[model samples]
Target: MSKIDVDSVGQTREGTFKYDWKMSALYNLGIGA
Candidate 1:
């Protein structure tokens, strides 16, 4: 959960959970794309 890094996570990683989406979104936004 808290230790998760969206960049390292993916869509199909067993128990991916929901935070994955959030982390990915944040990462994309952080890069200003």
Candidate 2:
């Protein structure tokens, strides 16, 4: 079982998803998206 809290997990997941989306958009534009 994990010891992490729900809010922390949610924030981390949200941040990661945002970062990934940003990076993907940048990469796509770089390659003509």
Candidate 3:
């Protein structure tokens, strides 16, 4: 249904955001070190 599709998209976006944030943090730490 449309609701399920919306939920899935939201979840995917949130997951990607979290992953990108973690990656950026790691990259910054490596640069600092």
Best by lDDT: 3
Q: Write the per-residue lDDT of candidate 1 for residues 1-33, one digit (tens) a residue.
A: 445664446555644655657767898999997
Which lDDT tens digits does candidate 3 get at residues 1-33?
Answer: 455455457577787577667768888998995
Kindly report which residue stretches of model 2 are placed more than 4 angstroms away from their true locations once superposed: 1-11
Clashes of 3: 0
Model 3 pairs in collision: none
lDDT of each: 0.65, 0.65, 0.69
1 or 2, greater by TM-score: 2
- How much is 10 displaced in model 3, in angstroms? 11
**Candidate 1 stretches greater than 4 Å from native:** 1-15
